[model samples]
Target chain A: MTPHLTARNAFIAALVLALFLVPVYAVWIGNNFVLSLFTRIVILAIAATSLNLIMGYGGMVSFGHAAYLGTGGYAVGILAFEGVTSGFVQWPLALVVSGAIAFVIGILSLRTRGVYFIMITLAFAQMIYYVAVSLNRYGADDGLTIYRRSQFGGLINLSNKTVFYYLCLVILMGSIYLVWRIVNSRFGMVIQGSRSNDRRMRAIGFPTFRYRLACFVIAGMICGLAGVLLANHTDFISPAMMHWTRSGDLIVMVVLGGMGSLFGPTIGAVALLVLEEALPYVISVAGRVVTGHDVATAKEYWQLILGPMLLLVVLFARGGIDGLLASLRRG
Target chain B: MLLFIEQCLNGLQLGLLLFLLAAGLTLIFGIMDFVNLAHGSLYMIGAYFAATFAAMTDSFVLGALLALIATFLVGVVVEMVALRRLYGRDHLDHVLATFGLILFSNEMVRLVWGPEGRNLALPSWLNTAIEIFPGVYYPTYRFAIIVVALAVAGFLYVIVMRTRIGMLIRAGASNREMIGALGINIKLLYTLVFGIGAALAGLAGLMQTPILTASIGMGENILILAFVVIIIGGIGSIRGAFIASIFVGLIDTVGRAFMPDLLKLFLSQAAASTAGPALSSMLIYLLMAVILVLRPEGLFPAAGNR
Candidate 1:
């Protein structure tokens, strides 16, 4: 067996094993918090993976990926507020709104290349953010609370945290599989070719812009789905979900885990969110050990460490966690 | 009539601040081809420095001066440590690395100065209103901002258009390879240019703190506006940035002030209230989108880029 193949296969096997067992382990340990956290991780992982479709594989560095999240969440929130709580109606409507918004944004933003594309996407996202902020009926900047979770017609109960956790996990795995297939398909080849060299792709008779726009829309739809999941998970939706900084966070997750890899973004989501959940504890412990003083505020300063770590990752670990994993297989 | 004039003045002030920011950004992007997202952090640092120094010295002017110098040094140090490596890399690397810098700077600022926003107290002389036109009074501090920004703009024009360094900068922007071949100390030039951009950002922040208060994430908002201004003006073009900033400032300020009321006249009050801010905010971006569609290169494509 090629060590590389064996190692990668083993890694995937381990990852799948862990993902499947998390909820069971949570139930056995009677730790609902673990289940909820993993649920949230799975949702964000879906969002990051959507971003990776365009960013890592397609080479479109959209600085405003969170706009879809906001749109999707608002879609569900606004519909629920208007007394339509059916998952069937709410989810489809949310996806449609996200798709339409993505279409409009893609049509306009695709005109430019390089830095202009990034800035334009950012502007559109901000435009949407302000729109959300101005939405007084839907709770404006304060966000809307989903009083009643989506009614799944007795098929599933999102209120039960464990069930919801499994749902998220299954969907996350599904997204990974879908993205994996897309990256290996003919359409994926076109997208990858454009990323490597748009001009060359064009010379080879590929209408690169159309392909890119399509990719953009698809990613937006997936992220929109993620947004719907996020709203249900948190039972809340706010304008802050679509903030440009939040978009940056999505980008960070995609890059941190491993760009261009099928499982990179999911791994990234876990790493980032888990780190966020754990850093405060790590900080306080380290603070006490090093400073030997009251270290309550050290938790607040955990980001001080995180910021440098991101810089170090960008500088030296461009392959991210996934890259390190792949290298281990090769070695 | 009075409100319109006042709003116009407000627009001018905002435009000038954006201009100061955009000018520096364009120069850096043009010459270095580096996209520094941490530019906003410099502005934040500037405001923080001004607040601290002003409080310590008990004199606004001295503190502002000290803040400017400190911010410039910080910019230089940052460029040296973090930004230097990012040169010649893809714009993505620049965006990502600078983003990391933004996180570090924001968190570091929080660590040093609690979470609260700080305000710089305007001197009494600068605080009072003055009648520029018959019976149309305005805050002296704001008028001062207008005058100071104009003077700086004028000074910048002279330095960029008439000086030896200006020629080099122009040359570097248009063609860096030739300059490097000529044995000019390119690294020093980049550091200096970055420092200037930092100082300009700091100045805008310090000048703005009295009015807006020095707060976390303040730079991010205005930074977007500055990006809008530059994009509308044309990337890598100071002249474009100048016109676009003023245009955006006026459209933003006036639209925000009057759009809701205007909508209220045509539509139900309930709808107007919700749509007003959203519509007004979208106006500038709409303009940007239209500009991108029509001119793609922006209204004033910098000669250097061509």
Candidate 2:
């Protein structure tokens, strides 16, 4: 009710409202495509939230976060291929594997700081990527397709578009809530403080390494959930899901959404996914309307536009869309 | 034994190529304190330039020279326009901005030259194998790469250790503020240093193009290797980068080529076949993790002047 509500709070409300209303609207409009798109947004938002937890809160700039997504998705795909389709079993297994891998990699990589940490994370991720690629049994580089969505003992049908969309929405909202709680909690304060000054945190008698590793594991586990959701959404799993560029995309989401904030990752996910989907259509339409020329061929160059847009944002808007809105509201 | 020697030579050639790329990267980071992720883009551009020029001119040497010059100019221009603003900013800002450059350049390359891989043929003279010993005849082109890389390393050593400009570079690497306070034209120096780094990366890209396939994402894999080298060598230390590049190159090349057979000795053939390639590719990383444990700073910290 208050106009003075901070943009972060406003964004959180809007996201929650959108999550509830979008699928219903999609059903009413009979355009379930909207549900699928927003479902993707929600899944990625969960993934980005995990990244933000470590990067924004814990001060660990991991360049390999997508490994969890890949790991999670592959878990479902591999399990399904081996004829295990139970969502309950598959999801928990994925989360544990991701968390365990993150813990191991974090322990080794956290020994180094700055550029070395970045490279080490990258190396570990690449190691996993190669392993995934070498798994000829699990479809290797070609990827595995899920013939059916996860079975939930008839309690939930992921194959039902509406049910699946709602399931993803619940998870996404739950993740954001979890991130909010953790960031506000004593643990979150310590993580944030460590990010601000790690040496100082250590000097103050905090075992910064353990805290950061724990944060890494949590973030990886959350991303693993996102991976599970993503596999459910697409009914596919491939090593491509964990490619470094995907990690870059996650970083882009965190930065674009305004890093360090609770709701920023969701905003970033919504903005980037929508932009990616809409830019070509909008540009082609504008070209026809303005010049009466078919610019369909030029649609392929849409990423060129994105490249410049990201550059401009990095140069001008350090805080991202949510940050920009907050400042404008303050003004 | 003969095959081992051949693999070792191949490793050395690859190591030298990596050294060329890493030297520039370490130098720029050491002196400018800028983390230019787009350094790999320069390598990509170098390969692209070599392909284009070599195709146009029908002479590999001429093409390589032209590519080198073009890459140097592009490096200087990029430094002037984008990198200059990032000097005083946070390392994160540099990372983000350069990351943007990576996207832009990759797209630009796709726009200019289609995404399909280009094959730049090595000239017949350079393509032939040379008898380095009675039983070991290595690719002449690869030998040339090693020679050129070694010469460049020697030149860099002299420039950094002996010359006035080198003195300034060392000074700048150790402490930028101190060098600036000494009334040096820090801006010009930075531009020159960046240009040199770009040229070195370009040289490696061009030289290795014939032996390695030229493709859109070639830089991506090698870029990670360069980073591993940088991490192992110690950031901002050219000597560290050089040594680490060779170490990584040897580990990677030889490991990939031989680790399956090596693992076969201990494990079942099926297990070795499955695990060998993955483990071999991971050797450099294992080396890096071990190095980090042993020496948080690289093997040879840059001249200790920062």
Candidate 3:
């Protein structure tokens, strides 16, 4: 096999092993809560993967994908608050609304290119955030809570940790698989070709706008699914889910994990959330051992590190972890 | 009728503040072709500086002046240290790097000032209201903001149209390579331009301190509005920014003040109450979308390029 193909297969094998092993390891160590965190990682991985489909493959950088998450979460939260407990209904509603919002926003925003596209998407997300905040009847700025997870015809128990973890795992893997197929399909080739050169794609007798718009909508719908899972996981949905900063965090995950790759978002989500959980304590311990002073508060400033890290990655490591691995394999 | 006039004045005041922000944003984009998201950070810094300096000297005017100078220097330093390296890079790179600076500066502020917002109280002399008409009294400080903003606008007009440096700036906006070919110190010019832009943003922030709460993320809300202004006015066009800022400010202010009542005419009180604020808030963006559809280059594009 060619090294590229060998590298790709090896990466896929490593990911499968890591996914199963990490959770098993968590259980073996009696740190069962890692399952919950990993579930979150899987859910967000789905969201970021959706984002990568458009941003990495279609050259459409949306800085407002968190809106879909919020929309999805709000769909579940609002319905639960109003006594709609069916998973089938709630999930489809989330997808449809997210897609509808994406279609509308993309129609207007896609008219602009580059920075304007980014800014307009951001503005639309902010608009939705404001709408969420204005809903005083549904808890407003504080967010609404799902009294119970969605019911699945009395078959699947969403509240069980193991079941929920596997459910998220299945969805995430499914999303990655779907994205892989979409990116490699004829339509996918058109999208990537548009990313590489939109003018050329247009010149080659392809009406590229519709393809890009469809890609945008699909990505939005996928993120919306993650949002539904997130609400179910947290049992709450707040306007914070859709905040611009949250959108920035998603972009960070996509870039850090390596954009455009199927498993990049999965790896990124795990790494970032884990770092968030562990970094503060680690810093404090390291600080105490070195200087005999408590420095737990340093974790509060982790964003300071992350921001510069993003810059360095952009400037020096444009390919991210996935790119780094591929280059190492080539060498 | 008097209330309408008062609201109009409020709109004008908000417009002037937005113009200060949009002018700087457009200039930086127009001339340097650099997308600086951290421009809002400059606004926040200006407000913080004003609060600190005013407290130290117990004189609002003195504090504001000091804040302006300090913010200008900070802007120049940031340009030299971080932004200079970003020039000629992709827009995405500029966004990422500046976004980093935003994170770093925000944390630094939190470290220095803590999280809670502080009040930059107006001086006693400027605290009183002045009767503008038979049935209307306006805050003297707000009137001062309008007046100062207008003066700056006039000054900006003269600089862009009549001055030698303004000529170079305009030329640079239209064609950077040719101006560089003419042997102008492009780096120095860029730094100066950025410093001036920062000063304008600082002036807006400092002036608004007495009226609004000075806080860590205050620049954020207004930054979006400024972006809207720049988009409506067309990027790189100061005159367009000025006109668009006033229009947006008017639309936003009037829409917020009256949209709920207007909505009540059609929808039930509950629905109107919910949708009123949201729809009104989206008016400016709707305007931007329509503009993008009809006039993608904006009403008055400075560079006039596709």
Candidate 4:
């Protein structure tokens, strides 16, 4: 087992190395677009990783995870709009509100199991989405623009691309390290044990609800931090950030990168986002070669490929990209 | 008083519409134990079919009938091809696969019909409002929707309670192995059950097309509401679905209509106005959360064997 896990560990280390080196490569090549794109990818990777902590290891599938993204974004966007420009205040506020909402949501939703849990999480998220839409003061359905991004007191500049990229990378690495430590800790074992068999855990005299709920909040808090970065990355916030589809996308990333693995979320985020960007061009080119016409329609149908691909993944590749890679390494 | 009456009536109408959508959902979920996120896509397809066929035939009734048949066929085809293989699998698998179906169906509709929404015109005869009382006026089309939905509800009740096929469905719901033991062609029954569910969702979709234009995302918004109803009603209980659907419908419509006014009684006008719409949208969800906390199996969780 030790020998086998070495391959997986090496892969994760290499992936982290690439993440740090990306901005360097981008700066050297003067490719600002790739830098910005990877920055978004990195932020979402943090969110996906947070989701993986609960969904993959802890076995709680909260479909409303994007609510944290919205809450965190709005915390900054609304504050920035109301003249709170300090990152010190805005960032912590983002974390607190997301944590609070997740606490409330986790408490309420954790009562149910299975499909009910999925639907309840989804409903709660929709509630938040509607609330965002009703915030006429903050732009309502049109969404809000953060005229000024959160400012740090001469310590680090978020407005600088390379500096921001490194900041995100460091935070992401820190988060992963945190998750790794927690998973090996006693609390994580309880969460995992509960996920596998809550009844058995209870029979063994463990009070699993508080542990799971705490896990839920931690995941939400981490995702909330990601949301802050996301709002900073985009310089905008909308109800669209919390839409159930975005939550579904995060889930897809987790599942595709391989659930129940340390590096799955990061891999999933990169692969899914890269595919989204590339599939259109690839499909159009293929269409041009095959159909020799309807190029525009073909490009639009990239989602057509995506839908079936997801089905195949669920049916045949449940372990996702990370799992596949691990298996290949073993062979 | 008149406004209150009107809003209540509107709530009832909306509730009945939601019931039409929820009833089919409960049946499919309760009987087959499959989760189809693409259920809404079928609703969208039903509306699109109505729009296209109505345009072709220029008669609302004929187009509707054709849409129902088309939707039934589509549901049967989907069940046979994709969903049949997924029975007894993990609900997560069902969700992911059906989510994929949603993407497929939505894009297919966009590819086939273009992204712009299509509108269905009500017949000129049913276009006007009728005064049900001395002062209360309601649209004939809306009144028609209520009557049609009620009829469907009655039809479902009678079929489920009184017919042999209904007996088979109930038995299957409670004991899947028992149904197979009884020499039932489980495949055919499942397909037929799915057919009825598809037809019901399609009917709801097509019926509401004249009220709201048949748009791409119509089914999704209401689908969540249907889930709320189902969650409140209980996952596999049609009876629970009926009660929960109307309750959600009333709470949603009535809450939205009156919440601002209610908020104004104590709060500043500006504050009330600011919080009203957002608070109103949250009413059903609040109700759902309360129900989940209080009764996790839902109010009328089917007394199935599981």
Candidate 5:
């Protein structure tokens, strides 16, 4: 392998190792907060990874990817609220519902190209969000609280924090592997081909639309799974979970981590969530040095920096963090 | 009968406001071929500026004029400093970058003006209810908004259809390369178009501020509505945006007003009450989806425009 490949592999190995040891590290440090934070990071990482499948690889920029997250979460949340706490039923139903919604959305939105596509997807997601908001029986805008986690017939005890963390990690890794395989397969090639040049792919006798639709459904299903975990992790499901901004967050993760790379989304998820957690503190420290006061409210303005940073990244660092890392060896 | 008239008037008022926002958005999209998700931020900024200016000057009219000019300048600066570089980039890049702008705008607003919303109070003359019919009355401010927006729409039509700059804009929309090749200052034209768009959005925002307080993220929901307007009306088509904005505004406003009571006639009260708001809210999107399925090019496809 080339030095670039070796460096990337080493980084991935180190990342995986760090993730696996998070629980152990948390325990040693006597900080349960770290464990829970990592759990959220892993779950969102799964979401960003699925978004990357279509966005990075398939060349579909889905602005409303978080709609599936809400669908999946609401599936679990509504079922559990109605006393259907079985994981088997809830998980499958979440996947099916999200997939079905994705299929319908893809059919309509995929008809339009460019800005129209982005707007349509956003509108569809908003429609779902409003629907969720109007469901008064299921807690409406306030959201529903899940009292019990999904029961897997004693196969896995999710109540254990360590078990849950590992479960999320494994699912994330499995998804990354599945995406890698999909991109390498014939079907994957067609999707990528369509992304690069749809008219050419169609001229070559490949039905680009159906392939893209299928890919969209797959991404939706994976994001839906992430939603299921998110609901369980937080024990709440609300329309807020599927807001357009949340969808924006997932896109940011995919873009920031380095699109199309298997581990980019995961790295992005970790980096973003960690930054969100740590940025306020960083700002406050810098503020203290400059103003000589705590600058208590400085933490709230982290997005001020983040927003421009994103612009800079888009304008200059289009390859994101993964690309940044890859460039390190050359430099 | 009075309620229906009032609702219709409300619909008309909303449609006019939406038209102002949609017109600018379509022009920018048509001429520049740039996808700006932060158009909504300009709207929000406009409202905030109006509120601050109005509060400071204690003269609503003067404040509004100053706010409009400020918003136009803000738009120009935004185009020059950031968005100008984004031209010819992928639509995805535009989306991501503008999405960042939205976040930055929101946070900056919060930092400058505390997290709470600002209310733009109308003057006594504008705030009073005007008797428009033998037994009906409507708020003068709403009436003023309708009149002002309609006048602005007319002004836009005159400029686009009758002016030399309008001809250039139309030409640019149809064939950007040819115009650039023909020695037109395409950069200046783009900056001018972007500024005008920002002004329109700000006008819409400022006008609505009296009715709905200037709040953070307020532009987002309405921005989506404008998107639907453009989609149904056809992107890059001013006439399409005008017709679509009014159509969407009427459907949304009237549907929300009547849907719950109408549903109650067929279904139980509780079910109607719950489904009414949801169904009404979803009406425009469902309409957009159907239009997408039926006529993906939208109702009015601009000539020689993608």
Candidate 6:
């Protein structure tokens, strides 16, 4: 193989290896925090991946993708609250409900184009958020704490930290693989074709809307699964999960990792979340070095840098991290 | 009956505040074709600046005036430094860049203002209640908001319909390139438009500060409402914004006030109590969805513009 492909492959291999070893490394260091953080990263990576299917490939810039996250979460939380703790029932219900909501929202929102589409999606998500907030029985605005994780009934032990982490990692890989296959399939092609020029695709006898809608529903279902994992991972769920800002964060992950690539969302998830985790320490350390006293508020100001960094990426690195790596290989 | 009238007036006040924010958003979107998610940041900044200035000067009027000018400048500088580069880019780019701006702005506010929210106290003269109808009294400050917002709406109408700049703005919205071909300085016009938008958002923010207090993330929820107004009103159509803003404002306020009672008529007391707030919050969004289905181009699409 050429060095170009080799370098990219090597990087992917390295990333996979490192992710698989995170728990072991954490245990060696006696740091449970790292394990939990990586678990969160893997779960969100699934979300970012699903978002990428629509946004990167299908050209649907949904500002309400987090709605499904909340949907999936609330399904699990509400079900568990009502004494339905079986993963068999809870997981499927999460997926089905998320898909149903996406279907409804997709029908209404898909009629509009450009900014209207973005705004409509956002509005629908906000609608869901309000619904979640008003669910007084399930903890409402303060969120619901799941005292018992989804009971897998010996199929898997989710309460065990390492086992849960691996399950998430496995699911993340499975999603990335599923997305890769879908994007390369005819359905994905139609979605992409519509994205590039919907009129022409329609002229060529493709029912682009149905295809796009299907793609939208699938992405929502996958993201719903991620939400299921997230709720299980944290043992809690809230309206905050579906907030518009969280949607923006998912978009940022997709863009930061490289849209349209199979592994872009995963990479973006790691990069964005890791940056979120590390930037404060980096800022504080830099502050202490520059000034002689530790800047107590340095952590809170990390977003100040991240915000500009996003702008710079938009301005210059339209291809994102994956794109950047591809360029390195080429050069 | 008095309470109902009072709620209507409250609705009117909220509607007018929405118009100020939506007008700026629609102008920027309609004319320049930029999706500025950070417009809310400008609103937040306006409130923050008003709070700081009011606290410093110990005079509400002086503080609001200074805050308005400061927000306008911030808008202009933001345009020059960042947004100018983003024109003609994909709407997605605009969304992402401005999303970043939202994050940055929030952090910046927290860093500068500390984490706590700031309160903009009303002047005593504006704080008292006035009887609009016999034995039907309303807060003077809220009544003042309605009056001021209406006057600004009138001002906006006159400007957009009668003035030379308004002519240019209308022309620009309808056909940006043709006017540029006609030797108009498009860049400067865009900057001026953006600054005006900022000032208008600032005005809304400052006006609201006395009621809601200046707080971090205050701009976001209302920003969505402004978006709904623009969507319902029609992009680039000031007339639509005016009508739609009031409609949305009334639905939101009156619905929140009365939705519980309405729900209780159908649902059991327990269910009504739980669902009331949720349904009320979603009233405007439901309206927007219906509007989208019926009139995708909004109620008042600008002439010769999509």
Chain B TM-scores, listed for every candidate in order, come to 0.98, 0.97, 0.97, 0.98, 0.98, 0.98
DockQ values of all predictions: 0.74, 0.59, 0.63, 0.84, 0.88, 0.83
Off by over 4 Å in 6: A1-4
Across residues B178-270, which tens digit of lDDT does each residue of candidate 3 receive? 999999999999999999999999999888888886788788778878988887788899999999999999988888888988999999998
What local distance difference test score does each model get?
A: 0.90, 0.86, 0.87, 0.90, 0.94, 0.93
Which pairs of residues clash in candidate 3, taking residues 3 or more apart in a chain or in different chains?
none
Write out the backbone clash pairs for model 4. Answer: none
Native contacts matched by each model: 0.61, 0.46, 0.51, 0.77, 0.88, 0.77
Which portions of model 4 miss their true places by more than 4 Å?
A1-10
Q: Which stretches of candidate 3 lie over 4 Å from their true place?
A: A1-12
**Residue-wise C-alpha lDDT for candidate 4, range B7-110, written one tens digit per residue:** 88788888887887788888888878888788888899999999999999999999999999999999999999889988898787888888888888888899
Model 2 lDDT, residue A121, Cα: 86
* TM-score for each predicted model, relative to the true structure: 0.98, 0.96, 0.96, 0.97, 0.98, 0.98
Q: What lDDT does candidate 4 reach at residue B228? A: 92
Candidate 6 lDDT, tens digit per residue, A42-88? 99999999999999998899999999999999899989989999999
RMSD of candidate 4 to the true fold?
A: 1.5
**iRMSD, per candidate, in listed order:** 1.1, 1.6, 1.6, 0.8, 0.8, 0.9
TM-score for predicted model 2 compared with the true structure: 0.96
Instruction: For candidate 4, give the lDDT.
Output: 0.90
Lowest summed lDDT across 10 adjacent residues in model 5 chain B is found at: B297-306
Clashes of each: 0, 1, 0, 0, 0, 0
Q: Which pairs of residues clash in candidate 1, taking residues 3 or more apart in a chain or in different chains?
A: none
Query: What does candidate 6's lDDT look like per residue over B38-143, in tens digits?
Result: 9998999999999999999999999999999999999999999999999999888999999999999999999999999999988899999999988999999999
What is the fnat value (0 to 1) for candidate 6? 0.77
Candidate 5 at B109: error in angstroms? 0.7
Candidate 6: CAPRI quality band:
high
